[model samples]
Target: MVDADQTFVIVGGGLAGAKAAETLRAEGFTGRVILICDERDHPYERPPLSKGYLLGKEERDSVFVHEPAWYTQAEIELHLGQVVVSIDRYAKSVRLGDGTLIEYDKLLLATGAEPRRLDVPGTDLAGVHHLRRLAHAERLRGVLTSLGRDNGHLVIAGAGWIGLEVAAAAREYGAEVTVVEPLPTPLHSVLGPELGQLFADLHREHGVRFHFGRKLTEILGQDGVVLAARTDDGEEHPAHAVLAAIGAAPRTALAEAAGLTIADRAHGAGIAVDASLRTSDPDIHAAGDVASTLHPLLGFPIRVEHWANALNGGPAAARAMLGQEVTYDRVPYFFSDQYDMGMEYSGWAPPGTYDEVVIRGDVGKRQFIAFWLAEGRVLAGMNVNVWDVTEPIQKLIRSRAQVGPEALSDPSVPLESLAG
Candidate 1:
């Protein structure tokens, strides 16, 4: 057992930081574990914010990870509304916003990513928001609720997960939603045009207006409130509010300032971590969106800003920090809830590797599984409303299972039966 005086300081109070502290207690670490977060709100599940919370289907407290009493019982110190400005490596301490020096035996940096800004004009308008923190979601939810009085239009910039989800959520609330994407298809960079087309159709069925191959040139505002937006295609989208869900950049400034090594991800920005989830400084560990951890399937570091990644990554990194030798390398997984569809995707597939996708059911009926294969090997599987295949698909990815198209397309063939 670690001495009660020994401190493990964690930065950022998102899913990652909370999970790490929870895991520490679970693993018999009775020493001091302090979670310092900049956000004053309690740690909550982020997935719900894009779906249920935005649509008023879930209350704010429903998404909370741990109650206040649980943290107290677990002996985890909560430092709410604390911003870590820098780290003093030589002093083995962190400098906070209020000039408090927090010394640590080991530091776990869960300083999650920040929303990427839209470089266009009028981005600072009152009704223009970015979906990253809980405050933003609540503020937008309130704005969406008040839309009954206004023209009730929401212009979402970028067609990424956040944009698509909020667009779907707003449409659910009977608000006019428009999505602007520079790519020919939203999520084209990852899911390809065919799958992306499915999402476009799905949203269109929900009455969402989409502008593909268009960029936001400017956001027009009246009295510092977003009223309209202009696209690169020379079109204007009427809006009561605009959400810039373009993307996110890792919050590595403090870690880098402390002389910690950082690396650029292939598709995003963040400090690079090894397979063990340790940064350049052995004593300092990182996870969540801020730390680009190694993915076994991709054979390189990936920064996945998702609830599952953070929840799982936090514990894995914490165990490694305790010299437990825990490996976080699992088949990459992500889940999304759009409309009534319950979706889960796994595996690493390079672009152009999947020319054919074998579907087990119908897309319109909202019951099916799509398998992305490269040649004869299973590259990835996307379960749409059907979750029965998740277990086998996960095993397949781990073993790099090679199955024929006939087996994949046949619903009668049990996925587990093909397990090697």
Candidate 2:
């Protein structure tokens, strides 16, 4: 291993790569640090693109984590718009698209993920879109800004966060929105059937059409603009725009090419990583959506693509690179804003391990929180507008305190009291 102050090369410039660079400085390592981002622009917050940014409430600049000057001032090289084509792990160097190479003592493979595209026919149509990058958001924004209310229909292929949020936004813009999800419930994999049903109700109440347990057979379009969607059931729904947010896959091509261990942790499928966020090769560290590591609360290796991981995993990976034996363990926290409602979930549900569930507040009243219970303790939690309570629950979960199911289901009990 090289000295602690040696060069660090990060492959992705999203949340993980950006925060890792920031944390390196905080840890007092002032050596040559380089961040290689494929995007042309500086690292910006992606959460807002579906919510505040789409609602016209936030400026693009306002969402940037750090201005370009921060990297320059900190003496960290920011190589924007550069794609790292391959990594020579044996040589401890990374080669870029331009055939230039940069060597590093320790590397961070924060290559993030790529948006899954529609494989069906007519997917090449012009009016179709996917929301993953800044350019994508711009294209969708242009469509919403210039479209007809009666004739304009946005057909979303998935009911995940981006799909649902775009549905809300499209409706706000007076565009008819139809969400096509193969799953029986919108967020079934994450929120359970009950809560997922609530989400379906919330959107249905607002004129959004839901086609559950259905798959898009093909997108019929002309001249690069979407026309309608032909479903597996032989049903056709007219559409002016098609948004494919089926999910994302781990960008593991470069990692695999470099002889790094790659697994099934792509898109709906998860990857496998150790407790320290190290791939099969310890020299190459992974983070963000692309990584599959041991979940702190569940005590199991489960790969998740969450906002909290992108934010927290970087610091953990950095600590490991700095030789500070740290684990990427934390309650998996993620939130979504839908139709003026705040929905959040924390902790991890051990695979097929949610033996019981307890609830607080009123689910119908829209002020509820559900606690996932395994062996009568909180493993994960979901809340609807009960954020203040979510904080204490998060702490209790991190501390691994023994808060019983009785108190968890009672509304009179304060969340903090369960911490001890």
Candidate 3:
């Protein structure tokens, strides 16, 4: 069924699109592959943007998904720093910002997401930064270094993963960091109160100040430079720089303009797609953060924005496009490295979904595995400072087995055997 005459145009050159292009070639698809990116940089992983790269632990060139020569070697039409303005679905063509149009037999949207901007006053100031791109990270790295050198203050909004990671990085540079969060604790929505408090304590131990249960009301600045951040609680915190790590919204403008069905806010507000990653238009597929797929196991439309999803979802979409039987049922997985702690979380267990959180090992020592369960069934597992357990944890979730708390909390019990 493969033909050399056919062409596949993939919009967005993040990990998902790049991997999709790689999958097409690997799956023996002789069709022409074109990858488009709005950013000038090559496809790069984002974790390093906050973790290693921002901390100066990783090289600037280490973030790219593949070497620059690899795309050329694979014969992928790499269109860098070019924006696709419109998608004429009916004509099977996309119009770029430069007034160039390209026809395609199939189209893939991996547009990903953008950082939610701070809406308060003075957000447009010079010291206000958002971490979502390589360029943003590059600028933030310099900001952290300057803040550290001058013993300046950095005020961060939101206590989510990005905020916390950057807080750790700023502290590593000996910069004073203050986190203003609307929630009661860090990562409250995802990890619940118990684990959230643990993270709050962890950051506090590293000399990070947390103004919990407060939201940034406005940013105070002078001459287009940030001075301080005012919270809803009538407290103004002196800040040399401010990082808005509130969250990200899926980049769905292109898909929406193309008359594609977008998921509601409850389903991640992304481009709605089936398990096969097919959009409303059968010929148009989506993946990565932009695609909200109806999950087979979860029985709900879910969009995962983590690196693992992009790493796997793209290849799955490519296989589906190749007319292969595909089910993108991968359990949502994510990892975080903050300060001295390294953690991997597998499966979904949002606050309301899980009834009890059982912990194994020592919490004070910060070496533990926490399992979230609903009616004895393990919904999610987070291993902190633990290694080689993600496979077993995922198996436990996929098996949908009723695991006992006693066994789950026992270090002697093997997780793999429990799944069996």
Candidate 4:
């Protein structure tokens, strides 16, 4: 049991950090709970930043995890806009950016990720943006609004979830958008080429242009403001603004500096943690994007950068800190929305891990549940424009049922009834 006088310090102010603080208090940890946040605003949900918040459909108040008043009432000390510079494992304390030191009996590192920037020339120019934080999204929203109504052209670099979602939102704003991807099909690695082609067709139907198998060579700007982009094929595409939504890198500098066991660089360079989310140092635990822990189902160390992972990792880390026996083995899940189509995927598998793709419903109509199977066992499943079926899909994966494609593709056979 933790001593009542102990202090618990949490770094990073994203959902993971906020949820960890909530878990600490909920589990009756009366000790000092200090949350160090680098962001000016209190912890908030990020999904809306790229969607509703950007479109002005959702208010700012709705995005925050908790009101400032809630933290005061809970007696949790929230040091906003403060950066944690270093962790002194020997001293059992952390040094702030301003050189203030704070001791802690336990610490949770939930430092999230930042958007990856394009290394091309003219990225420093104004109107070139990446969407990982609220500020970035807000700036992109303003540009989208101004350029959208004029039917301005918006050039998107990368065709991942964020890029596609932003493309959809830009189109909704009446902007002519073009997505540049270096792959034959977008999301080809994750959803496989077949499903990726389905999405490609979907976007094309909405008049969104795509330039596949092309690389961004440079961003053309005039007077420090973006105007267009050039591809490797020596073709210039006009653009009022450019959004590079490639991916995000985990914020693991503190963990690396603290001498925590960092996984191989190929494995995402995250803080290597055990099944309980405990890092090399027992008192330090890493969650969120910064953690690369053993995945029970995958039998490997996979670090996922999804909302659900952060949401679930927080509570699990807190419980483990209290010396409570626990295993952080929940199946990974994520969702995306674009152009009247919604998708929810459960479970994780490396690209090419599965040999067969089984589908139910109608792909031609853009409504279907597709499962990726390896050796007749369901490894992952995705429901597109299909509702109230994620539970059954998750159950199917967990059961590890050796189900045939015929039964899996049969709409008459319920997923829950499989494995029997």
Measured by TM-score, the strongest candidate is 3
86-110: candidate 3 lDDT, tens digit per residue? 9999999999999999999999999
Q: Give the deviation of candidate 4 from the true structure as CA RMSD.
A: 1.6
Relative to the true structure, how large is the alpha-carbon lDDT of every model?
Answer: 0.85, 0.82, 0.94, 0.88
Model 2, residue 345: C-alpha shift (Å): 0.7
Q: How far is each candidate from the true structure, as Cα RMSD in Å?
A: 1.7, 2.6, 1.3, 1.6
Tens-digit lDDT track for model 2 on 192-304?
77677888988998899999999999999877767899889999998888899998788877877777766653222333567787777777788888887866556656666
RMSD of 3: 1.3
When summed lDDT is taken over every stretch of 10 residues in candidate 1, the lowest stretch is 263-272
Per-candidate clash tally: 0, 6, 0, 0
Q: How do the residues 1-420 of candidate 1 rate in per-residue lDDT, one tens digit apiece?
A: 347687899998999989999998888887889899898887777888788888888888888899878988887889899899989888889988999998998899998988989999998889899988888888988888777345499999999889999988887777899999988887887688867888998899889999999899999988898789999978899988999999888999998888887876674567778888888888899999898877766677778877778989999988987889767786778888888777898876645867677788788787888888876778788899887677888887676667888988889998886657
TM-score of 4: 0.98
Q: Per-residue error at 254 for model 3, in Å? A: 0.5
Question: Candidate 3: where is the Cα deviation over 4 Å?
Answer: 1-4
lDDT of 1: 0.85
Worst 10 residues of 4 by lDDT: 1-10
Q: Between which residue pairs do clashes occur in model 3?
A: none
Candidate 4 lDDT tens digits, 187-206: 87678786899889988988
Ranked by TM-score, the better of candidates 1 and 2 is 1
Candidate 4 residue 217 Cα shift, in angstroms, is 0.9
